[model samples]
Target: MPASDALEGIQACVFDAYGTLFDVHSAIGKHQHRLGGRADQISLLWRTKQLEYTWIRSLMGLHADFWKVTQDALDFALDRHGINDPELRADLMEAYLKLDCYPEVPEVLSMLKDGGFRLAILSNGTPAMLEAAVKNSNIEQFIEKNFSVEEVGIFKPDFRVYQIAVDGLGIRPEQIVFLSSNAWDAHGAAAFGFKVTWVNRFGQSKERLPGKPHFTIANLLELPNLLG
Candidate 1:
């Protein structure tokens, strides 16, 4: 795709993690394959529990951190699936550390950077997770920086989580284009005054939020064209 069209007034494109750039779901799916008949069922439980625990911990101010939340979630999922295999759980977590990259990611990020747009990460992932993902996924070269919410000790949809990018960039809110695969993150960034882009990969309907994205695209492949 050509960069002939992109979002107007967009100097930088900041991304949300866990889904936006990494194929996070693939981690569960691939590992669950070893579980045979219960693959999808168990995988779904793991992913759902992972997110649920994160939110619950965040709300309760328990703050176990994303890594701990991940492990705890997997434990709950394994119990639900009636699997007590430690090796299987280990395999699943390993897959997460080595998550697959979306095909369009490298090219799009390279093109965006070549097209002269600043690229950065704004994620709920821990500093280590974000760094590891960026390095292992081979998308690091294209990213200008990785911002983590560990500094704030909270989860996203909270205005503070989005600020990791703003404060990291040392730029005004209007100077950035906030992009996320998650609508909630998009909403939070938009509310914070960054021009938002909702990367609607699944074609999901937008949640009712006062902070709507400035652009919506099916995937990153369509983004360069859409932004223009």
Candidate 2:
């Protein structure tokens, strides 16, 4: 379907927390002055490893909370870049709790809520982590609930993780509209039967996966219109 098309029968809008609603790279961006030349590289690696660990742990059936995975990813990224400062490591971890939301997030969410759509977050982040990010960004009021993988002890792309929204929202998969900036995540939600929207905030290419998104938009600013 085209990006301008509206998704019918969507009772609730479920979002991917980390990259969708909140800016994951902002954690490292906040500390770029300390790293000098390696800021961008470290930020990219940290996010890569964070996501990699989630999939790996899910496969192994050895689930850890997202907070632990986040810390471990940061450790690996810091070690790889050959910058071993305990203070920097501690500061980066703390920065993650309050990562900035995309500039359009608040307005888009407010518009959607005003339009009478139910909103919630479905993410690999633990409840505490999701809570901190939402509250920190001051968008908590817009979200009705935050669904974490901790409930099922697995990460995204797993059918079970997506079911959390279906069960919690008391709606069929087709009735929920799932949004994610992560290509694989958008594909997974679509595979699970939701109308998926790939929020291509960074202009990334589409993923070669089993399911395709119904719509693709550059940012959440286009969301309300697409839903209507």
Which candidate's lDDT is highest? Answer: 2
lDDT of 2 by residue, 10-75 (tens): 789999998999999899899899998889999999999999999999889898999999999999
TM-score of each: 0.92, 0.97
The best candidate in terms of TM-score:
2
Task: Please report the TM-score between candidate 2 and the true structure.
Answer: 0.97
**Alpha-carbon RMSD to native, per candidate:** 2.8, 1.3
In order of listing, the candidates' clash counts read: 4, 0
For model 1, residues 5-49, the per-residue Cα lDDT tens digits are: 334566788988777898777877776558888877776777778
Worst 10 residues of 1 by lDDT: 1-10
Worst window of 10 by summed lDDT in candidate 2: 1-10
Model 1 score (lDDT): 0.81
Clashing pairs in 2: none
